[model samples]
Structures are given as structure tokens and as C-alpha cells.
Target chain A: MKAVLEIFQNVHMALYAIVFILSLIKYPVYKNTSLKFLPLIFLLTLVAESMGMFINKVYESPNSVIYNIYYFFYFTFFFYLFMKVINVKKYKNYIKIGIVIFWLFYLRDLFFTDIFNESFIESYIVGAGLLIYCIILYYISILQSSKVLVIKNDLLFWISVGLFLFYIGYLPIKIIRSWFYKENSFFWILLIIQFSLVIVMYLCFLTGFLWMKKKS
Target chain B: MDEKEIIIIAAIAIPISLVIIVIVLFSVFARRKNRMLQEQEEAKKVFDRELAESQIEIREETLRNISWELHDNIGQLMTLAKIQAQMAQEKPEMMTEVSETIGTGIDELRALSKLINPEALKSLSLKEAVSLEIERFNRLKFIEAKLTINGSVMPIEANTQIILFRILQEFFSNTIKHSKASTLKVVLNYSEEELSITAEDNGVGFDKSDDFLGIGLKNMKTRAQLINSTLRIDSEEGKGTALTLKYKFV
Candidate 1:
């Protein structure tokens, strides 16, 4: 079971390398906008995910604050980039509101309750929130398509779907936690699924960047 | 909070924030770059237009200088030859030959000089110039050109005369070059309101309505624009062409 997890992890790592190289080549050519930024965000996310694996296994790194920092940057950049591409200038106030709400929820999780001790519930809630935001982002992406004055493509759609699926995939780990608790095999399966999803999302983002640059 | 809960929360928060920040910065940068490109394109267009205007101005200046040189130098030489030939009329045979030869030579020189210079257009008047041009054209065997002036010649400014003469020459040159027409007609008319010149050729006509511009036509249009005159060409492939030039003579 560990071997299978290791294989999946290796594949994810290889995919991450491929995506990083593709993105580095892409960003210089593309230069600006949501499309260019998406790839860099993907690269950073991949790095964070790898670092996360290292800390989990070897360092037992004190829940490295750096991991949380990376995650914070990743989500904010992704959401804002998507919004800019869509040019939801009117909905900008909504974004500020959303950010505030997110911060509120985050602080509530960190300081207020023993709720974080409930691993299943905590995973489920976090996954669900991201899932909801992903859905909102997808809807924004759709609304953006209608009156686009600039580059358009199906790649963003695919990336959004990858994110949605990863969110859905995350739900199972929470739902079946009782059955898989303290089971290294189950944890391995969950990690493989999640990491595979990360690879898929990165590829999708890379594809989007390429399409935009080619059009330009 | 337990490790699992903390990790889960962090995962969601971190990725989202990072992506948004990068995108905003990138967008601002892109917009700045795009603006620079647009400004560069505008500058190029302005430069190109200025170059074209300068070229046209230089050509007009050269033509004016050549016209003045022909009249002042060549005209004087022809006059002197005619006077010297008249004095040599003492011997009967020599007088006839010299007189006839000198007269023909004088006519030829005047014609050549007219070809070189559009002539003192203001002194000749538009009507007289049209008459002279038609007479010249009538002498050619293959094509017949007719002129009609309907109103008394109005005194126009010297600058306007030179500009107008060049425009007429440009039109006639095009007709001779492109139109294998048998007949050409020019009409100069004035009313209480405006002065108008219409030249029509029953030669190979061109469709002037086309959006695509030919160089000759573009040159004609530019000349018309320079003088603030309205010029129109009506033509078809085989039918013929009629060009009208009109301006308010204030």
C-alpha cells in the first residue's frame, strides 16, 4: 500500500517538474494578466505540496508556518487572477466582502473552538468551503465568457473542473474517516488521490496559459 | 486545534490568497505594456503622413522652378532668334528659308516650353489654357479634344492658378496614359456662386467608386485636397470617364 502511495507521489512530483518548466517558459512570453500568473501560482502550490510531504514524513516540522503562508498566497492569487480575467469590476466589492468573510472563518477556526480537533469535521468543512468557492469561481468564469473583450478558451474551464473534482474527491476522506482512521493504507490512498488531482489542475492551468499566449 | 484540522484549514487558505495576489500584479503590468504598444503605433502613423506630405511639397516646388526657368530663359532665346531671322530677310531665297524655318522653330519652341511649364496660368486664364490644350490635342490625328468656356474668365490668385493648373495636368496626364479614348472634352464655367472645371474623356473609363486606390487617382485626390476642391471621377470599364473639379471662387 505504501509502495502504491510512493508511486503516485513520484508521478505527482514528475508532473509538477514538467509543469514548472512549461510554466517558466510560458510566463516570460505571456508576461501579464491572470493567465500568466496562474502558472506561477501552480508552481508555488507544487513546491508547497512537496515541502508538505517532506515535513510530514521526515522533519515532523512543527506544522510549518511556511506551509500555511504558501497556501494563503496560492488561494488569494488564484481567486484574484480569475476575477481580473473575467473583468468583474462591478463585483469587486463582492470580492472584498468575500475576503473578509474568509478571514473571519479562518480566525474562527484558528482561535475560537476545539472544532479543529475533530479531524473529519475539520477536513470536511475546509474541503466544502474550497468546493463552494471553486463553484463560485467557475460561475464567474462562465459569466466572464459572455462579453469577453479579450482572450477566451476552454482550458480555464478544464482547470476549474479539475479543482471542482479535487474538492469532491476531498469529501470522501472526511465522510469515510471513521472507517479509515489511523489506517496508513487509507491515508496513502487519500494522499495519492489528492496529489494526482494537483497534477491535473497544474496541467490544466498550463494549457490555459499556452492558449492565451498563442492568441496574443 | 489538532494537526489534521490545522493542516486542512491552511491548505485552503494558502493557495487561494497566493493566486489572487499574483494575478492582480500581472494584470497591471500587462495593461501598462499594451498602452506603450498603442502609443508607438500612433507615432508611426503620424511619421508616415508627415513624410508623404513633405515629398509632395518638394515635387510641387521643383515643378514651379522648372516652369519659371523655361519662361525666363527659353522664351527669351526664341524671341532673339525670331528677331535675328527677320533681319536676315534681304536675300529672297535665304529670306524665305530663314523666315519659314525661324517661324516654325519659334512655334515648336513655344510648344515645347508650354509642355515644360504649365505656362503663366493666371495671365493665360483657365479658359485660354483649355483652348490652347484642346487645339494642341486636335492637331493629333488619333484623338480629338474639344473645349468650351461658358462664362467670362474670373481673375484668380496666382497661387491658386498654379495649383489648379497642376491638378488639370495630372488629370489629363492620366487620361493620356490610361485612356485609349478617341475624344476628350473640357468645359470651364462660372456662376455667381462657383467656378467649375469638367473634363470628360470617351476613352477607356475606370470605376472611380472602388475603395482601393490607384496611385494616379490618389495623387489627383491629394492635389484636390490641398486646394480644398471637390473632385469626382465617374467611369466604367469601356464607357468613358468624366472628372469634375469645383471650388468656391470667393
Candidate 2:
């Protein structure tokens, strides 16, 4: 069980690298201006996850600091991508305001609340923000677009669904992590669920990258 | 299981279920939206095809009118001028009548030239086009036609004007061929947001149940719908026929 769980964790990192490589291959073919940063996002995720793993496993060090740094990078790239895809001029101001508020809370948590450890509150805040963004993306994809005749093949639609499912699936685990830590059986079960959700999310990304057509 | 474990299990189950539900809902919603958009595109394509067909029909109808006018009106006028010219050579006092006949033929040729030019047909406004039709009717002595403009004239889309003119042309053709109408009146009312046109003929109109209003009326209604306009036709036995069209500017 331990060996399988370790393989699952490593596979998640490998999936990120695969996604990055796929984006690189697709970069020259798909000429969407909004998708220029796709490979960059996957590259950042791969580096962040590998570094976090190295610091925890090989160096025997706390990796919360790496995660703290990575969370900022992840949110920034995703926020920009969503803003570009949503393409609503009026909502840009609201997104800017949301980013400001999220950073203020994140910085406060980094300095004061859990300076040396992981801050579940900060993770929860970012998760909630991303969940709302995904919902808004879905709303715009459905209501604002009449030209897209095949929504199933739409890249943004799949990305939004992946984000929505992952956040919703992981949010409960994040909230109840402390309780699960003291219960061995519950911890394993929740771990399995969390890993499964991550796998599904990465699969959704792969599907989106593979199925998306070149913008005309 | 303890209470915390059960609560955790329920919490996990609820969100997973919610995720599944949302994904399914999005798929259904997207399919519905896509189908609606496709239907709209199909409708627009049909409208475009119909509009193109109507334009061709208008051109053909104009050509047919030109052919008849050349053979009947202009041909007869030229023959009369030739006869008068020959007479003037024999009798000097007949020169004035010969010159008058030639001048009248020149005027008829000028009017026919305007109708023959495709650019002129496309460039003319609804009012100008209707005026030309009325002038043709009066010159041919087919009917007494009058056109009245009620309000300030507003520029309309050229394609829309052509379609409307063609519809009125069809009505005039039917009135002259079947109605035995002596008088025809057309009114154009241009309001701030809407343009209204009414054409009424004092002739022997058929009953509402008559099959005479078949393809012609359907074509007119379809053309009006293509321009987002409304058309109404009223007729009764022995009463005159009236056609009203109201179009709103977006």
C-alpha cells in the first residue's frame, strides 16, 4: 500500500511533465494568443512539484515554504489564463480586486499565522477563489458564446470543469485534514480520494490539450 | 464507525456527487445551446437564399416589363414619328407635329433607360422607385396611380427597399391583370422608429377564401419576415384589396 501510494504521488508529477511536453508540441500548431502561457503553466507546476518533493524526501526539510511560493505562482498564472479566456471587460476590475484581497490574506498568513508550517486557511481561501472563477468561466462559456457548436470539444470548457471538480473534491479534505491525521483508517481513505481527484484533474487537462483544435 | 468518520464519509460523498451532477448538467446545457445556435444559423441561411432568389425574380420581372414596353409603347411611338416625318416632307406645315412625336418618343426612351439600368434600380430609394412605378402606370394608361408621402423621409436599407418594391410590383401586376381596377393609391408613412406603407386598389377584390392568394402572398410574407417586417392583407368580395406593411428600424 505504501509503495502504491508513493508511486501515485510521483505519477502526479510525471503527469505534469507530460502535460508540459504536450503543450510544447501543440504550441507551434495552435495559434490562440490566449494559450501562449499554457506550456509555461505546466512547466511551473512540474518544477514546483519536483522541488517540493526533493526538499521533503531527499533533504529531510519542511516544504511548506516551497508550497507557499508555488501557490502564488499557480494562482497568478491561472488567474491570468481565466481572465483572458473569460474576456469580459467589466469583470476585469472585479478580478483585480479579488487578487488584491487574496494576496493580502495570503501574505498575512505567511507572516503571522503559520509562518513555519502549512496554512490550511490560506489554501482554503485560494481554493474558494479558484472555485468561483471556474464557475464564472462556465457561466460565460454557456451564456456568452453562441458560436461554439461543440462545447464538449472546447478547451476552456474542459479546463473549467476540471478545475471545478478538483476544487470541490479537495475542499472537503482540506477542511477536515486535521481530524483525519489522528485517525489512521480515515487518513488512508481520504488520501486515496485526494489522489484519485488529482489523477482525474490531470486527465481532464490532458484531454483538453489533446482535443483542442487550432484556432482559425 | 465513529460520528466523525461518518460525517467525513458523508462530506466526501456529497461533493463527489455534486461534481458528477455538475459535469452532466454542463454537458446537457452545452448540447442544448449548440443545437439552438445551429438552428439559428440554418434559419439565417434559408433567409439569405430566399433573399437572393427574390432579387433574381425582381430582375426577371423588370426585364419582362422592359420587353413589353419596347414592343408596345416605344415601337408604336417611333412608327407614328416615321409616318409624320414622311408627311412633313410632302406638306411643310406638318413639321411641328413630326417634331412633337419625335420629342415624345425621346422622353419615353429616357424613362425606359432608367428602368433598364441595374445600378439605377439598386440606387433608387423606396419613394423614388414607387414614383417610377406610378409614372409607368400613368404613361401606359393602365390605371390612375397616386403616391403620397406622409412624414419626413428616412433613408432605408437598399436591399429592403428592393424587396418591398418587388412586393408592391406583384400587387400592381395582379391589380391590373385581374382586378380591372381604375384607381390605385399608395401611402408611405415614415415615423421616427417605423416605416409604414399601404397600397389600396379600388377594384373587384375576391373573397378571403379564394385560392388566388396562394404563392404570391406567401412570397410577400416571407420577404417581409426576412426584413423583420409585418405584412397584412385585407380583401372582400366586390371590395377593394388593401396591403399594409410595417417595418421597424433597429
Candidate 3:
């Protein structure tokens, strides 16, 4: 069982490395301003994720400060990367507001959670916020699909659906973990589901990226 | 990373890598295909341009044919009528009737020749040509027309003068045929930077929201485009219509 889990982790790392490398080469070809920002954000997230994974392996408890810092950076970079890819003008102000709110929430959680009396539900609250944010991004992506002239309808639909499924995948990991305190079995299964979702999201973006060239 | 991690990562990595590769291939293929399509579009545009030029040539040929017919056939008939009127004066009884008939025929022939080609415009600039047109319009029974030249005549290409004359004729015919108008004003303004013309009439205007494509108006627009001029129109229902043309110097 350990061997199986280790194999999955290696595969994930290898995939990330290749994706990171290819995106670096592909960045120059995308002249669109929004798309041009994507590869840099992805590279930043990739490095953060790599460092987080290493920290996760070295530490036994979830209380490692280095692990938490890497984790924060990882999620932040991922959010920024997703924001770069979605081409919608209406959400411009909304994204700024969301980042401010998220930053406030993050700072509040960091300062208030351990020093003051805090509940175990704090992590779950963060997860819920992230889930809600992803839902809004998915909605924005759907709305923007019409305005983005270069993307095909079907591919846009798939990307929106992938985002929705990713949000859904987070729910089981967030709600069930806090409420039920299930065994490690649930954790592994949730991770696998989330990994599957990442694959789906990548595929949808790949489709959208390829569809752009034919649009004009 | 250990063997267990390797296997699990392969499970996720394989599919993702495959999707990425497929996407790259599709992008390359689509770019090549779009290049071919762009070439085809360029070829089609060239073909259409050639076709449009041919059509314009055909129209010019038709106009040339009508011009010769007026100059040759109608001009000869007018000369014969004038000679017959002079011969009728030799007798007293039939001279009045024949002379009157010949005089009316000569006037109709002269008008027909002017419609075919405004030869009076050949020696004049655009402003002078427009003034000649206004003088002819005033001679008609029912037209209350005015011509105004606001500035000194600028030197213009003779070809441009011909195009402007045809455009003015089209406007007059449109007012006569469609616009139930009593007064028409033709204004010409010349400056170093641009040449401008304004033709306005108090008329029963039609609804403009609906697509109204008049052939004469379309021809005038094409002529304007050929000379890099802008044409603008302002009209209201039951009010009036104004046409303006401004030519860019550079």
C-alpha cells in the first residue's frame, strides 16, 4: 500500500515537472495579455507545491511552520494562476475584492487561531472559503466564455464543468473530515478524487488552449 | 520519490501527459490549416477585386456608348431640324408652325445631350460646374433651386470634376423623382486641406431605420470611396435631407 502511494506521488511530481517545462516553452506563443501571465504563475505554483510536498514528507504532524508557509504560497499561486487564465473584465474588481478578503481571512486565522481560543473548525472554514471562491471563479469562467472570442463553446463548457467538479471534490475532504473524523481510508480516497479532478482540469485547459488558434 | 509514489504518479501523469501532447499537436495542425485557409482567402479577395474592376469597366463602356449616341444621332437630328426651320421661313403660311415645332425639338435635343455628358463642365472647376448645373435647374418650370460658392475655386483634377458632376446629376434626379421638394440648395466650399460639398432640400424624407439602398446613392458612395472622400447624410421623416462630401487632401 505504501508502495502504491509512493508511485502516485512520483507520477504527480513527474507530470508537474513536464507541464512546467512545456509551459515555459509555450508562453511566448500566446500573445494575449491574460494568457501571457499564466505560465509564470504556474511555474511559481509548481515550485511552491514541490517545496510543500518535501515538507509534508519530512514532517509527521500538520503543525510544521515551513509546511504551512509553503502550503499558503501554493494555494495563493494556484489562485493567481487560475485568475490569469480566465479572461473576464466584469470580474476584475471582484478578484481584487476577493484577494483582499482572503488575505484578511488568512491573517486572522494565523494570528487568532493558536494564540486565542480557537476551534478545530478553523481549517474547515478556510476550505469552505476556498470552495466558495472556486465556485465563483467557475461561474465567472462560464460567463466569460461568451465574451472570449477565441474559445470554443464546448471547450468552455468542459472547463467550467471541470472547475465545478474540482469544487465538489473539495467538499468531501472538507466537510466529512471535520464532521465525521473518518479513517485514513477516506483521506486517501479524497486525495485520489482530487488528483483525478486536477487531471480533468488540465485536460480542459489543454483543449481550450488548442482551440484558440483556430478561432481567428 | 519511492516505488509506491512512482506508480501512483504514473497513473495520474500518463493521462495528463497524453492530453497535453494531443493539445500541442492540435495547435500545430490547426495553425498549418489556418495558414492554408488564409492563403485561400487572399486568393478569393484578389479574384473579387478583379471581378469588381471588370464590372466598373462595363459600366464605363455603357456610358461611353450613350455619349456617342447623343453626340452623333441626336446632334445630327437637331442640325436637320434647324435647317428645316430656316427653309420653312422662305414661305409665309407654314413658317410659324414649322418654326415652333423645330424650336421645341432643338431644346429637347440640347437637354438630352447635357444629360448624357455635361460638356460645359470640361473647362470649369467643380464650383463653376455646380454653378452651371444650378443655372440649368432654375430654367426648369417647378424647381426653386439655389447655388452658393463659399470660397475661391481650388485647382482640382479633371477626372474628379467629372465624378462630382455625375454625383450632382444623381442628386438632382433623386430630388426630381422621389423628394416632393420645392427648394434645393447646392453649396461648394474649397480650402487647401479639403474640398466639401453640401446639397440640401426641403422634402418629404423617408424612414432611414429601414435598409434603403438607392443605386444612384450607392454609385456615388463608391465614387467617393475611390477618391478617399467621406459621405454623410442627415434626414428626418417629413423634414428634409442633407448630403455632405468631404475630400481628404493627403
Candidate 4:
């Protein structure tokens, strides 16, 4: 079981690296599309993840600040995409408010609250919830659009599916870690589950970059 | 309340929730696929309906044009030939002119007979179809109609051609019947990825409100949609009216 857990842990970041490399190779396919900057975000995540590991190991300090900033940008990128893709006026307004709320929370969590000591769990939770809501709204918009006919070939749909699945699976894990990590006895199992979700999420991203050549 | 109890609860609950999420996602995917199939079926039906209607409309318009030519132009030629033949009884040179008039009337009647054949009309390509309409307009002196085609003519699907021709036909009818313009212009530009058709008439254009959307114009809009093309109709009161349809080849 420990060996299995170790394998999951080691595979998580490697999967992200594979997706990052694939996103580069497929850059021209989506260069003129709304997903043009999506590869850049993947590059940013891989760099941040490496930097986080380096800081935690070399400095013997918490690496929460790096991830806090990374999550902030991640949430912002998805919100920007949702704003562009989603058409419903009511949902658009909700996404705008989500952006504002995420920004305000990140500012408060970073400057006013603990920054380097612990990860920004509360703000991250808020960001995740809003992103999930935005994705659902985007799905609803796609249902009403002619785009649904070509959903399989659509890059945005694949990316949204990846985001939706990973976030929904990881949200509970995050809650348990933040609220009950100190007292939790099944922490290893949850960590392994979290790592598995990361691997699946990266695989989803790789699938999108590899096969999504149809213009969205 | 104990740490061990909380851990046990979470382990069981998390996987259960994940299973539910997976089921829900599967259902959503299934529903989206069904909706997409329905949409494709709906589009196909609309295209077939529009094609049949446009074919009928073209036949009716051809009959109208043939009737007008037979009564007004060809009929006038026959009457003139009869008077010229009577005059020829007195002058030998007038006989040659009377024969020439009779020959022209025979050619006009032959052209009308070809139009009366459904097979000949069905075989016309999109360009040929539009050319025939322009020729009829100029021959009838309805307006000084001009068709300017730029770039090599790319082959469009027959179904798509029907919709495109009908849209331009609607625009031409409106120009001749209501515009009171002396001239009408049409351009078919074939680009690398798309075919653009533009028509304009210098006339008393109508207001840009929904009130100006007649059934003919609305039908044109829907037909363009059926073919996955864009139809834009722009007009300024008293200035002129212009229509542009862009159809990208798949």
C-alpha cells in the first residue's frame, strides 16, 4: 500500500510535465483561438510546481505562498475564459462577481492573513467553488449553442471537463486537509486519492492538446 | 467527534460522492449527444424544405417571365411582321426585312420553350442560374442588371446553391418590384475559404426596423442559416439597400 501510494505521488507531477510538453507541440493548432493562452498557463503551472518543490526542500520552509499565487492566477485564467465563452447575461454577471470576490479574497488572504506559514485554503476554496459554478454555466451555454453539435471536436469542452472533474474530486480532499489534517488518521489514503485525481486531470489536458484540432 | 471517527466518515463519503459525480457526468454527456443529433436532424429538414420551395419559386418566376415575353415582346414582333409583310406586297426590299422580323420572333419562342423544360432548369449551375435571371432582367428592361464574378468559380454543393440562388433571387425581386432603381448590381467573389455574394440597388431604401422585414427577406435569412452561412441585409432610408451573404466551404 505504501509503495502504491508512493507511485501515485511520483506520477502526479510527471503527468503535468507530459501535458505541458504536449501543449507546446500543439501550440499552432489553437494559436488563433480563445485557447491561445492556455498553453502558457500550463507552462506557468509546471514552473510553479517545480519552484514550489525546490523551495520546500532547499529552504526547509513552507511552500504555501507559491501555490497561493499559482492558484490565484489559475482561478483568474478560468474566469476570463468563462467570461468570453458563456453567453447568458445572468451567468455572466455571476462570473464577474466571482472574479471580484476571488480578487478581494486573494488580496486579504495574502497580505492580511498568514502568507508563508500555511496555504491559502479559504481563498482557494472560494476560487474553486466559483470556477466550478462558472464551468457549469459554460456547459449550459454550450447546450443552447450550435457548438454542442461538434462538442467532441471542441477543445474548450474537453478542457472544461478536465477542470470540472479534477476540482470536484479534489475539493473534499482539500476540505479534509485544511480542517482535519491534524486529527485525520486516513490522511495517506486521501493523499493518494488526491494524487490520482491530479494524474487523471493532467491526462485529460493531454488528450485535449493532442486531439483537439477542430477550430472551436 | 474523535479523529479516527472523522477519518472513517470522510473515506467512505468521498468515494461515494465521486461515484455520484461520475454518473451525473455520464448522463450529461448522453444528453448533449442526443441534443446534438436532434439539432442535426432539424437543420437537414429545414434545408430540404427550403430547397423544394426555392425550386418551385424558380419555376413560377420562369413561367411569369415566359408569359410576359410571349405577350409583350414576341407577340409585338409577330404583329410587326404581319404589317411589314403587307407593305412588302408593294415593295420587293420590304420582304427581306419582314423575314428577318419573323426569324427573330422564332428565336425568342425557342428560348421560351427551353425555359419551359424542367430538365434544362434543373441542370443549371449556380452561376448559370444567376446569369439567366440577370439576362431576363436586362432583356425585359426591368433594370440594367449586372453580374460581376471575381476569382475562379468554385463548385458549391447543389443544396447550398439552391439556398444561395433563392436569397439573391429574393433581393432581385425586391429591387425590381419596389426599389424603382434604374440599375442593379451583383458580385460573386470566391475567396480562399469562403464565397461572398453581394447585391445592391440604388433606390429608396426602407427603414432598418423589424417592420421592414418582409416574408421574402426573412425567408432569405432562414435559408442562409440552413446552409450555415451568414446573411446580412443593410439599408438606409432613401439612400440604397445592400445584402451580403458569406458562405464558407466545408
**What digit string (tens of lDDT, one per residue) describes model 4 on residues B93-198?**
9999999999999998888788677888777888898988898889878899899999999988887787788889878988888888888889999988999999
- What are the per-model DockQ values? 0.02, 0.13, 0.04, 0.35
Tens digits of per-residue lDDT for model 1, A75-149: 566556555655456555555555565555655655644432333244234535654474465455544343223
Residue A62 lDDT, candidate 2, scale 0-100? 77
What DockQ would candidate 3 receive versus the native complex?
A: 0.04
Worst 10 residues of 2 chain B by lDDT: B3-12
lDDT string, candidate 4, A1-216, tens digits: 768865775586687688878877877887787788887788888888888878876997888878988898899999998998787898889999999999988888878778887888889999998989998899888877777766767778778888888888888778877876653366877777677677767777777766676563
TM-score of each model, in listed order = 0.40, 0.64, 0.49, 0.75
lDDT leaderboard ranking = 4, 2, 1, 3
Task: List, in order, the clash count of every candidate structure.
Answer: 24, 0, 16, 0
Q: After superposition, how far is residue A147 of candidate 2 from its true place, in Å?
A: 3.9
Cα lDDT tens digits for candidate 3, B65-143: 4565456655666677667667777865666666666676677667656654645434666676666557656754446
Q: What docking grade does candidate 4 earn?
A: acceptable
Evaluated at residue B45, the lDDT of candidate 3 is: 71
By TM-score, the best candidate is 4
Cα lDDT listed for each candidate: 0.61, 0.78, 0.60, 0.83
**TM accuracy, model 2:** 0.64
State the TM-score, rounded to 2 decimals, of chain A in model 2: 0.87
The residue-by-residue lDDT of candidate 2 on A1-216, one tens digit each, is 788789889889888888889889878765556768778777888887888889888988777776777677777666666666665676665666666776777777767766446644665466466656645754665666663565666666666667767777777677667444565455666677778778888888889888877655
